[model samples]
Every structure is written in structure tokens, then in C-alpha cells.
Target: MAGYEYVSPEQLAGFDKYKYSAVDTNPLSLYIMHPFWNTIVKVFPTWLAPNLITFSGFLLVVFNFLLMAYFDPDFYASAPGHKHVPDWVWIVVGILNFIAYTLDGVDGKQARRTNSSTPLGELFDHGLDSWSCVYFVVTVYSIFGRGSTGVSVFVLYLLLWVVLFSFILSHWEKYNTGILFLPWGYDISQVTISFVYIVTAVVGVEAWYEPFLFNFLYRDLFTTMIIAWILWSPSDILEIHPRVFYFMVGTAFANITCQLIVCQMSSTRCPTLNWLLVPLFLVVLAVNSGIASSIENGLLYTLAAAFTVAHVHYGVRVVKQLSNHFQIYPFSLKKPNSD
Candidate 1:
């Protein structure tokens, strides 16, 4: 984490001239989430670092993912003849997810409240969020990928890519347009996923196996809700470690978004395609090339691991570079040197 400089001298200079720019026209974010965040931000003391709040929210989502992974590693927990995840886990997930979402909504306000807003905070927040887009979605898929009404893991895999695309698209929009038009779907997706989690807790996973209308199972309803958010806004290969595939995709997108954030802060043009995606594309191709399942699984794991290491290394270096450039600690509220 220390003595690393992945960001180039040119990029460091870019950071010197960086200025944060963004726009949020999202109705939910503007009208609902902002007001809610305004109230919630008051709960924290001024000394609290916004990055801490952002990181805490991210950990909650990670905890939810771990919980689901332990209980339903195969996404078949509710399939007949398999053990169902305890109802209480779902209840806990629901509450924790809402809390995480709330923290995400308010972290920026906390930054402004303390008068400590910095490019590092924005990078840290959005970078964690890029990964979070995967974790929470994978956690929620447990609800739809259970029992007789289960959506195919393949479908869910594709859905995860869509989620990543949405995330990167918003950042990419900022890259090109110079203002992030916060996607309308983001708020809707979070609220809907949390609601589904609680409902699953109340009615039990089996209740979701029943059809809702004209043979459209609750699983379809769930996936459709995700799709609906896309059409109005003009928006995987499951089996043998679906989440690894998701991790690969998520990291690829995260790198893209993080780079975009750098460019956004530095007022530079972001590349249209990231070199990281080249390896990701090759891995995806090899995995789907009818290769042996053992080999496919191995490839997924290797790619996921590679992407994670690279993304984290890049993130650390970028943060360090920004901290040096700005003369402020990454996750601290300490004042810069006055001498």
C-alpha cells in the first residue's frame, strides 16, 4: 500500500489541477435520497471522515454477500431437496442492506458537513460503490434464484453484467459529458432489492416459487423489475463459480469507473476502452468456448484473482498519489500541514 506509484507523473500533475464536477438530476436521489441523507448526515459528528462512512457501508454489503455465499453458494438453497437459508438471515440482510444504502446516500453530505470534501473522498466512495454494485446484486439474486421459481444462474450472470454496465455507464457519461447523470435506476434498484429481501424474510423463500400472473413466477417478476429500469432509461455464464465471473466483470468495470473518476477529477478525457477489459474479454471467451468445466472454472478463478489484485493495486496507488498531491490523509480528518 505504501511506496507505490501506479499513477504517472502526468497523472499526478492531472491531480494537481483536478476539480470535482458532477450533476445529479435523479428524481429519487434529488427529491427523496437527498432529503433523507440531509437528515441522516446530522447523526454523525463533524470529526467523522466521509470515507469511513463510505467504507462502513461497503462492508455491510460485503457482509451480506458473505452471508449469502455461506448459505447458498450454489444459488440452489431453496431448490427442492436442498436446505433453505434461514428466514432470519434474510431479515438481517434486509436491515443491513437498507443501512448500507443509507450510509452511501449520506457520506457525501457528511463530507460537506465537515467541510472536508476532497477528490480522494469521491474516488474512495465511487470506487467502493463500483464493487458494491456487484456484491449487493449477487446477494439479492439469492431471493430470485431459489426454489422451483428460480431464475437460471445464466440469466443472473447476464444481469450482473448489466448492473456493472449501468455503473460504468454513469461514470463513462461523466467522462465524456463532464457531468454524471446519476442513473435513475440506481436508487430504484437499491430500494427494490431491500424490499424483496424483507418480503422474502416474511413470506419465506417458498412463497416466491409460486406464479404471480400467467405463469410468470416471482423470479420473472424480479428479473423484469431489473429490466424495466433499463428500457425507460435506454440501458453471465453461471455454474462453476458464478460469482468469480461476476468478480472479474465487476473489477473490470471498477477499474474503468475509477479511471474515469481520476479523469473527472483531473479534467481529462477518459479512454473509451480500458486495457483491463482486454484480458477480461479473452477470459470470458475462453470460458464460454465449450472448454472443460474444470478448466473453465479455473480460468474464472484466475481471472477474478488477477482482476482483484490489479484493481486493488491501482486503487491504492491512486489514493496514495492523490493523498500526496493534496497533502491530506486518505481516510482521516486531520488538517494539512500549516508550515
Candidate 2:
């Protein structure tokens, strides 16, 4: 469908009636982070696009991922015979992460400060966040390393899904309630991750390899904290390659989250289960139920490609619609001409 429109005429009309409603009950957000963001946002010139700030922050996190991949491709940095990541890398990552977190907090405020707030800005911000969930978690996993020296990749995969789901659920909540109740876990996770990065810089990754108590290493504590807060299956359904499996899960989650954002922004009713999930669910059932064991991996890879293309296309269309409806450039601060 060359002319597929992700947002309908009704939804486009609803966008005109869209109102941004959100509640931040976390004292950390309200009392601390919000106040700090207010002060920091003043430093940004009004000419800067909030979307620019959002995109820059996202790039920094991606850069961190690249750095980790270069140093610890297998997540075995601390294991014997593996090259250890430098102390400076952790320090650099820590500093960059804090800055990204700050920019994220300040972007919306910057939009409000400059009187350039638009539904598109919120969409842009949250949409990027849906992907950032993967980057930040994967980079953090590099710190602890994978395998016997740290958490397993399979466990990390599961943790990453927990995070992605939490993110999707938050937006889903907004879809139903018409109010985004900002989850308390977000601030806590960001702060803790930043702190861990800095700590690793100071004490070195070796420190984490040691046990905190009762033969339980710091990795155990780290994993426990995440479980208190929020993998991969060997089942026939999960017969696909690990990397392909990760992409499939991540893409599916991103698609669902972006769709929910569309619903929230347009003030429309979100489907209880997005139509995209139907194939994903069926793949799971067919493989595990022994109906498609022989071609399970092929099905997974196909699903991965489909989900990724569908999500990217949906995002582009929705952005195009919103930009046209509002008469604003997606990433530019320039005023639209009346001509």
C-alpha cells in the first residue's frame, strides 16, 4: 500500500482536540529534577529546537553503546583473557549519560520556555525514548559483562524486555487514562545507572566482580535490584538466532509503543491489542506447539523484518501528518510561511 496512512482522517481531526495531560507524582521529578531542569533549560537559547536537544541526547547514548561494543563485544571484559575496558571509558559514559538524562528532562521545558510546544515535540521525545530503552540497557550490561563473570546475555535480554514493557505500559496507561502518570521507576533507573557508571570508573570493573555478601557478587545485587524493580526462551518458539530474536522483540515493542503514542496524541481509543501482535503471538504458538518447528527461525527473521519496516513507516507517516496539520517543520524551528 503505497498510500498507507497510519493516522486516519478521524484521528487527524482528533489531533486538533488533543490535549497534553500528564501527572508526575514522583517527588524526585517534581521537587528535584523538575526544579533543576527549570534552571538548566534557561541556559539553552530559545532558538534551539527541542527536538534537536532530544536527538542529541539520543546520539550520546548510542555513542556509549558503540564504545562498549568496541571494548566488550562479547561482554567478557572482566573474564580472563578478555581485554578490559579502560577506566576513562566508564567516566566518559557516566558523564555523557548524565548529560543525556538532563537534556531529556529539559527538552519539554525548553519548548515551553520558548513558546514552541507542539504535540509533535512530545511525540518526538517519547518516540526516541522507546528506542533508547534498548540502548541504555545494553550499554549498562557491558559494564557488568556477560557470562560467568556477570549476567548472562539471555538474562540481559529478559531484563531489557522488562524495561521495554514498562515503557510501553506507561504509554498504554496514558492511552486509557488520557493522563500520562510518569512512572517513579524511570528517574530511579536513570540515576542509579549513572551512579553505577561513575562508580565503575572510580573503583574499576574488577570491584563488581567481587561479592558484596555471602558469595553474592555485585552482579547479583545489580540483577536483584532490577528484578525488584521490573529473557530468552530455549523453547521451540525461540529457536531463532539470538541476535535476530533480540531484534524481533525490540521491534515489536517499539511498534506497539509508537502506536500507543499516536493514540494518546490523537485522543483516540487504542486497540486493546495492536493488530501487529497477532502474527507475533501466532509465531510463538506455532513453534512452541510443534506445528512450525522446522521453519521457526525463518518465521522469526521474517517477523523481525516486518515489524521493523512497519514501525519505521508508521513513524514517518504519523510525523508527516502531524507536521502538515500543525504547519511546523519536524526538526526545524523556522516558522512556516502562509504561502
Candidate 3:
């Protein structure tokens, strides 16, 4: 009686959703705490299929771990507003994304291998993935960089457009549409998250190597990610907006190709380790600065730009490929189905 606040019957009905705070969750070891990870896991019976919930919870754990690791340094403005998602929340989210996607395997294999796949289950799984991807993306902006406002103003548009457009055009060919439905759309979402992890790691390194390198790198690399999404829009919209779709795709692709080339070339040079070049770059920047001629004398702007570009681009491709290979979903709610 010392402190009970009245909760209306309506509020009480929804308590299950918030009852998730009952358990203490760990960043690294989530599988051990099955119920802890799966907010709704408590409801499922031992006999009933628990693969989906288990996987989904694991996905959140993955994201949570990553975000905690990466975004903790900056203490961005967005962390406080996400309710339970604090600054360390990014890592939790990363792990969460990771787990949910990994479970995609159990969901499918159990169905195909165990002969348990159902249309309703498939639909629910996919729907979960789509929503999860959106959640993680939004969380990325919320925890770091400029957080929510920046996402609202810029990030969301590109993400939503690509996703929605893809959803639309995927139906043009039923077979192709089926492909788009991979783990219920988590395929693309996972790809995006993997890319972000790679890029962010590079950015972190840049911040350590030289403060402003990330700022420059962010400009170019961020453009690549956003452009890729925008360019993909045309492919998604061909059915609903054919002519316009082609125009958008054609134009965006050209720009995107240019970007990819520039980025890829720089990326190629990033890890090559040119110790001799560092001093040479510095001399050039020193000579070039003050006057236009002093460009590369002190290894100033040009060298910095070169370093940043390499880190960003290589990360974009290599990490993305690796994620795909491993089936780690960064952007989508899709879980792993391997093994």
C-alpha cells in the first residue's frame, strides 16, 4: 500500500507487453536466458513451436551487443528518448537483429525438414522480419549520429522508399516475387545492417586514427548506402510506375555506378599498408597548404580523404558479402535458418 499507483483495467490488459522487464538480460549470453530474450516466450508451451520466438529474441540480443560496443563512446542525443533503448542499447539491438535473423533457419528448416511449415507461420515470420528491420534502422539513428530527428529527416525516407518500392515491384514476376520474400524480407534488411556494422566500425577507426576522417568518410560512404537504396527503387516500382521507374533506375544507376567505382577503388587501397606513402603524403600536404600548391605536403586533406574512402568502401562490400554468407541479418528481422 505504501506506493501502489492505480492502473486502469485497460492498462492492466496490456501489461504483458511491458512485463518484459521481469528478467535481467545479458548482452553477450542471451540464449541461456530463453524467456529473458523472448518477450513473448513465456506464453508458448514446450510442445508448441517455439523456434520463431527463440530466434527473434536471439536476434535482439545480437543487435544489443553490437550497439553497446559501437555507439557507447559518443553518447549521442538520441539514446535517452527510445524508452528502454539506452545508449548501450545500440549493441543490444545489433545482437537482437542478429538473433532474430539467425532463427530464420529454424523456422524454415523446421517446416521443410520437419514438415511443419505453415502459411500462417510463414506470413507471421516474414511480417516480423519486415518490422524488425525497420526497428533496427530507426534505432541506429536514434542511438548515434544525429539520432531520431536525423533519421526522420533523412534516413527514414531512403529506407522506407527502398523497402516499399521493393515490396511493390517484387510482384511483377511471381517467381521473383517469391525471392523477394526471403525470410519475409529480412534478407535485404540483414544486408543493410551488416553494411552499417562494417561502416560504423570503419568510422570508429577513423575517429581514432584522425578525428575528422570519419566526417569526410561519413559524407561519401553514407551517400553510397543511401544511393543504393534509392537506385533500387526503380526495380521495385516497375509494375506500378513503369516509365517513371525506368527513368529513376537508369539515372540513379549511373550516379550509383560512379559512386561505386570511386568507392571501390579507394577501398582497394585502404588496407594495402603503404608506410612509405604516409610521409610522402604529409610532405605533399605541407607543401600544398597555405597556398594551393601545398596540397599534399602535410598529408592533410587529400591523404585523409583517401584513407577514409578506402575504409568506407571496402567495409561496404566485404562486410556485406560476409554477412550474406553467414546469413546475419543486420537490417531486417529475419533470423538465421542455417543448420
Candidate 4:
């Protein structure tokens, strides 16, 4: 098995094998988007590599970032005012983001259908997704205007950190329990982002800056809703179904607390292969916070470019290492083992 840590084929085939599989609790994805993605998956040629599909979708997001940079070079500026980029730019980015979201769903199906599924595929897909989450938030900040004060910057940083934490928590859950449970929040976020795009297209990006109810900015209201969901959903107060609330709120707290305890009790038992990588995110959070507060356009672009290159490099290294250890050529457009 080429030094690979292999699980037994019988174990893989058992009824509980995929019990922890990535479960999407989103109604829109379950009822509407998945069928559409299945159809799209069917259209892809068998010879087309699934990893390529995944990477291409991520590239579209990168293109979205570039488009923002090109259209509004002052987007990251420390200046207090918002950029006057055309309304169509927001519309274009919105459409591109939706396409990226759709393709993100399609890649896994393409992998399974073509028999090319591998751990590498899962890692690659998710690793890119982790980075894309940050990109999406940064884009939103640019549109709404970067926060100039320390408090505002902290709020933005905290929002970004929580989103990333939720993602990291999922991986930690899988590491501990061997199941990947996708929360309802993920689905709701996708739909909300899509809705944001449509709204931006209709009303223009400037509308987000206007005061809504009680003199709060529309963007502030949206942020408040997200923050409220993060804090309040775990309680028994919401009208959500019990099982769903448990899945969303209870699971998140458990994953976080469990991982923290593990890390505290035994260094070797940490769920992640690279524990240092986790802290690097905090460093990024701080750096980005400073950049947002100072409105340093040059540092912002430099950091973005650096992160893109470094992330891709790290992703390739992970895939290569996993491929070597598992003896599975994930880059090959071939079918995976049935077992």
C-alpha cells in the first residue's frame, strides 16, 4: 500500500461508512440547486478532471477579485469614502459568484460520476472554499466601504474569523467523528449571497450605503443579522425545528469546545495535521484588520496576492503529499475504486 494508511475495504463498504458524509441541510440546495448541479455534472465529459473543475471554479472567484481591483483601485484605500465603480461591475461579479457557487457543487458530483473521487478532491474543494469565504467577505467590505476605525475593523475581522471558524469546525468534526456534517448555515449563506447579488444588480451597490430603519446603514443591518444568527441560534428561542437547531447550533459549539479540549490535553491528538496553520489565520485576521483600518490599498493588494499564491502552493503540496501516501493519482481522469 506504498506506505499509505489504508482502511479495510470491508469497513469502507459498511453501512456506517458514509454516515458522516458531508450533509447539506440547506433547503434550497437540497430541493432546488442540487438537481440543477446533477444535470450540469452529466454534461461534463468523463475525461475532464474533477480537480480541474474545482480549480476552475476557484479561479472564477479570483477573477471576481481582480475585477473589483481593476474597476475600483481605490477600493482598499484608507480614504473614508466609497468608490464610485459602475453598478454593472457589481452585477457582473454577482453573476460570476453564482456561477462559482454552482460549479463548487458540481465538482464533487463530477468526481463521483467519473469514478475519480479521492481524499485529495475533498481537501482541494474545501481548501479553496476556505479561501473563497475570505474573498467573498473582502468583496463585500469593498462594496460597502472599508471600516476606518479600530472598532469597525475589529467587527469585520470578527465576522471573517467566525465564518472561517465554522469551516474549520466542520473539518475538526470529521477528524474526531469520521463524519462530515454540513450545517444549515452554509446553505443559508449561499442563498443569501446570491440574493445580495440580485439586490445589488437591481438597486445598485450605493443602496447598501443608505440608511435603513432607525438610521442604521443597510449593510449594518445585514451584518447585524449575521451576528445575531451566530450568537442567538444556539438558544431554544428561535422558531427553527429542534433537530435543525441542534445540528446548527449544538454541533458547532460541541465541535469548537471538543477541538479546544483536545488541543489542550494532548498536542499529538490535535485533529489537524498542521496545527500551526490554524494560528496563521489569526495572523491574517490581524493583518487584514490593520489594513482595513488604515485603508492601505497597496498593502491590501499585496496581501491578497500573497495569500492567493501561498494558498495555491500549499494546496498543491497537500494534494501531492496525499497522492503519494495514498497511491491514488487524483489528477488522473480515471475512475476511483468501488470499495
Candidate 5:
């Protein structure tokens, strides 16, 4: 509450609202999912805070994470090279993840309907999304058969790093261009994760690790696809449009390298609070790589906890900065004053 500004009920009706523009390219999300979420949004009560929806969705992911930690055989040394995760767990995780995915869209619509849209909402949504990306990937890795090995863990960390980089780059683009340019790969990745969960439930984890034929395993094929996507994704975006390329790939890479430079030089004028982004990301990668090499489940959970705490601190700082810049309360739930 120290960083939060309060608005009286009498002054709640006149605050300006920010427009939301997410450039989604997945055909299902654009044509079907958005409409479904909008319909769900219409039924949400006026007083329901958008931040609550965002937080709830994130909590669901957290729950699934806990479940994985407790039940995943690959997560601990007690069951070395043993995988007995129940089919029901995969089903539950898949349903929860999909619901979370749906709620991610719903929260923005709820904010607009209630006239509570704010930069805090955008930051909160993306912040949770960044963590969710790691959680989902880790969940898959726990069951990935070859995931416990050194090389496999490195590959997993690389994948997660790219995912996080893409998420942060989108925010940097918004800061520079004032548009939330969602990439097509984001939608594809979400759908792929959801599908992986479903497939795991149907076929079980062994199928994923078993050799298909002539020593080629499903995991090998999946890894190849991931690497191929990383290489080809830019060209694919370039084919779609140059502007999309500029925002998604061009600025993304630029931010990865030069964002800290800009932040340092412009801190007096811009005051970017999340200056630790790159450093913390590197720490996470290093820590996870060590854990992977040691196959230490305890260290993995510790890393997760550390990442969560760091991000929460960073998020609060960002919200405070945005609140001051905009002269509005952070995470306010009430309708703005109309007078």
C-alpha cells in the first residue's frame, strides 16, 4: 500500500483509460479465442478487478508447478530414471494451463469494460506471462525423458531464455513504439504447450522418450523443431511484414544487447526501474544450468523461488514508477470519476 495511491469514490469516474492493442497472429486466437474471451468478459461484474483476474491465472500456474514438484519422478533423485506420473495429472495440468491462457485474454477485456485499464495491468500481465513461460517449459522438461542430462538441460534453458527474451522485448517495443505487438510465435508456443500436455496424457511420458525407429526418439524430433524455429522464426516474420519484423526480431535482439546501455545512459530522463532484467536473467540461466548439471531438485526449486521473489520486487518498483509518471493509482479497481 505504501506505493499505491488511493482514489476516493467521488473521483473514480473521470480517469482516462489506455487503449490495448495486442497484435496476435494465431488464427485460432484472432478468430475464435478472442471472441470467446470477450463473451466471458461481458459477464464479469463491474467491480471485479482486472489485476485479480491476472493474479488468479498466475496462481493456477503456480499450483500446477507445485504439483509437478511433488509428483514428478524426474524432479527428485528418489525416482532416478523412473517416471510414474499419473495420466490424470497431465489432464489436470493441461486444463489448468488452457484456462490460464484464456484468462490472460479475459483480464484485458475486463479492464476495458470496467474502465480500469492501466499500465499496471499490462506490466502485471506480461510479468506473470514471463514466469509462466518458464514454468510450462520446466514442466515439460520434467517429463521430457532426456531432460535430466546436462546437454538436455542446457537446451531447455536456452529455449526458456528465448521465450523470456521474446516476452521482455515486446515490452521494450511497447515502451519505444507505444504498441503491444504480440508475435505469432507466442500463440503457436502456447498452443503447442497445451497440445503437448494433452498428448502426454493420452500417450504417456514413455512414448515421448521411446525410440520411434532406428534410434530416433520423439524428444529428438521435438528438439530439432525447436532449433529450427529459433533459426527460421525471423525469416518467417520478415515474410509476414517488415514492421512486424522490426518489432519482433529486430528490436528484440537490439534490446537484448543494448537495452541496458540505453537504460544506464537515460536513467536520469527515463528512470527504467527494471534495469536488472538482463543481469537477473543471466543469473537464472547460470543457476539453472548448475542445477541441471547436478540433477538437484532442491536447487531447482530454490531457483524458482528466487526468480519469483526477484520479479515480484521488480514488478512493484515498475508499478510505483508508472503510477508516479501517470499521476494515477497503481492497480486501482474502481471506475474513474466521470466529472
Candidate 6:
């Protein structure tokens, strides 16, 4: 009943009992991630509305795609022998991807704090994400394929998967039955471990046997981490699934270990961690432009075929009401009739 409150615990399936356990969240990111900048976003006042954050994310994604296309791999080069095209193009593409992901993290925070967490906001957030995936895969694979039949298959299938997910997610939200590891509590260790792994992947120093990041952070791998632990949390509810329960536990442990690692690995030596993601440029780039070979092309074709089938099946299930997703959040939105 206080400050634009909406329905909480809007039950979809059995996720009504979603609890705030140790594994699913971290406390810090829940708050700090919101756009509380000191007069930085000039056009709109900081407090105008958090809705702009959502728009900002979309713009960034578009910018990234455009940058990639303009710098087409046919024109850009990365490393000495790894030459592709224009070096600045790749650099800009990577930087833009980094910016998009970072913005992805901020919008939610701004929404909740500003009490602007509307049904439209949720829809826009998820919709943009799906589109971003679409644009990214299509643009990159198309070029990486260099007009090969194999590349066509992979791009086609990967896109089918994103489309299916987006459709189902919208319905899931409409019915208020999204899968629940829990609700909007930010899990600290889960994110920290992800960042650590990404960092490890970038450093050219030494590649560990099992991807040192993974071996070093078993908790992140095992934990069923989500954005469920940062905000309103309690310890009373029992988990409906054993596997999910354990994942949460592992995430908690991993979060603790990551904090320690940050302390041990920082240049300032103050145990602080930075969350921006320019370092992931190569990974996304890889997804965009895979290497060309007969075997690689064959695999792309197969993946495309399988995903297409999966997309068809998901549509069938939704149409027949054979699916019943359990939603963890108790909040409800008045889904607008699109018809």
C-alpha cells in the first residue's frame, strides 16, 4: 500500500512459494546497479523516469549492430595473422557490445527504485533483449559464413531459438508464470563469478586446464543463481526442487570465494571489482563470425535444423496449453489486449 505498489507474489504455477535462499542472489548489485549518476545523462533529468534506461539499452544494441556491419569482417583485422578487416571497426564493435550489456544491467535497477516497474517496462526489457540476440547472430554469422551454405543453416536455426524464446517469454509474462529460481533479489556471488570467468577467458597469460575460471569458481557453476536474493528476502520457504536448492547453495559459496579472489587479484589491492564488460569483445565476436571450414559449416547446418524443430514444437505446446510454467513472482500486471 506504499508508493505505487503492485500485486506481489502473482502466482503462475507452483513457484508461488519462491523463497530467498542463499544461492540465488547477492546483496550489493541489487542497489548499486541503478542509474544514480551525478547529472551525467544530460537530456533527461536523472529523476525524470527510469523508462529512458530501457530505451537507452535498445539504442546501444542498434549502435553495436551498425558498427559491426560497417566494419564488415571483409574490411577489419584483429590480430597480426588474425587479420579480418579494419581494426578500429572491430574495436568499436567490441566496445559497443560491452556498452549494451552494461546498460542491460542498469535498466532494472532504475525501474524498481523509481517505482516505474510497469508492465510495459517489463515487456520492453525482455523484447529488446531477444531482438538484440537476433541482430547479433544474424549480422555476425552472415559475414563469418562468407556466403557458405553452412553459415546460412546456423544463422537460421539460432534465430529460430531466439524467436521461440521471445514468444514464450511474452506469454509467460502475460500468464504470470515465468520459471522461478526465486524473484528479484540480486545474487552477488553469481555475478562476481561470471565476471571472473570472463576476465580469465581474456587474459592471454596462461590458459588453465579446465578453464581456470570454472575450476576456481565451482560455486558459480553449481549454483542456480538468478536475480532473486538482492531485494526482499526471507529464509522460511522450502525449495520445491532439490537440484535448484543445491544450485542456490553453490552460488552463495562461489560469491564468497569471488570476493576473496578480487582481493587477491586487483592492481589497487583494495578488493574492489569493476563490472563493465569490454573484455568480452572476442567472445561475442566469435559468436558473430565463426571460423570457416567444411566441418564447421556442417555443424552449423545441423544446429540450425535442430533448433528449427524445437521452435515448431514449442509453438505446438503453447497452442495446446500443454505447457504450465511456474512463476515465482507474486506480482501481477494487467496484460494489455494486443488484439
Q: Best TM-score goes to which candidate?
A: 1
* Deviating ranges (above 4 Å) for candidate 6: 1-45, 73-83, 139-156, 159-339
Clashing residue pair totals per candidate (backbone < 3 A): 2, 1, 65, 5, 8, 25
Per-candidate TM-score against the hidden true structure: 0.83, 0.81, 0.34, 0.63, 0.63, 0.37
Q: Report the C-alpha lDDT of model 1 over 202-225, residue by residue, as the tens digit.
A: 887767663322222223322343
Highest-scoring model, lDDT: 2
lDDT-wise, the better of 2 and 3 is 2
Least lDDT summed over 10 consecutive residues: which range in candidate 5? 242-251
Regions of model 2 farther than 4 Å from truth: 1-3, 209-244, 272-306
Model 6: per-residue Cα lDDT over 1-339, one tens digit each: 122211122221222333212222323543553333222234344464444565676676667556645554331222224334443444455455554555556665555555545433443454445445444443333223322112233223333334333333333333333332322322232234334334433552122112111111212211112212211113211111211222222223222232222222121122233121121122223333443222332333343344334333432332122112321111222222322
Lowest lDDT block of 10, candidate 1: 226-235
Root-mean-square deviation of every model: 6.9, 6.1, 22.2, 11.5, 11.5, 18.4
Score candidate 2 by lDDT: 0.76
lDDT per residue, candidate 4, 177-277, as tens digits? 66667877876776677667667767755555532122222233223433343343332112222112212222223233333322322222444333323
* Clashing pairs for predicted structure model 1, backbone only: 157-236, 158-236
**Total backbone clashes of model 1?**
2
User: Higher-lDDT candidate among 1 and 4?
Assistant: 1
**lDDT value, residue 12 of candidate 1:** 69
Candidate 3: C-alpha lDDT: 0.36
The segments of candidate 5 whose C-alpha lies over 4 angstroms from its true place after superposition are 1-21, 73-81, 147-151, 209-308, 320-332, 335-339
Q: How much is 110 displaced in model 1, in angstroms?
A: 0.9
For model 3, how does the per-residue alpha-carbon lDDT over 147-249 read when each residue is reduced to its tens digit? 3332222333344345533433332222222233222354545545644544444343222121111112223332343344334432232222222222222
For residues 1-339, what per-residue lDDT tens digits would candidate 2 score against the true structure? 555788888888888887899998998888998889999998998889999999999899878877877787667886667778888898889889989999999999988888889988999899988978877887887677654567655566677767876797788888888889899999988888888898998887767663221122223222332222122222423222444555566666677788779888787777666667667667666665568767766787798899888887877888888888889987878878844
| lDDT scores in order | 0.74, 0.76, 0.36, 0.55, 0.55, 0.34
Candidate 5 overall Cα lDDT vs. reference? 0.55
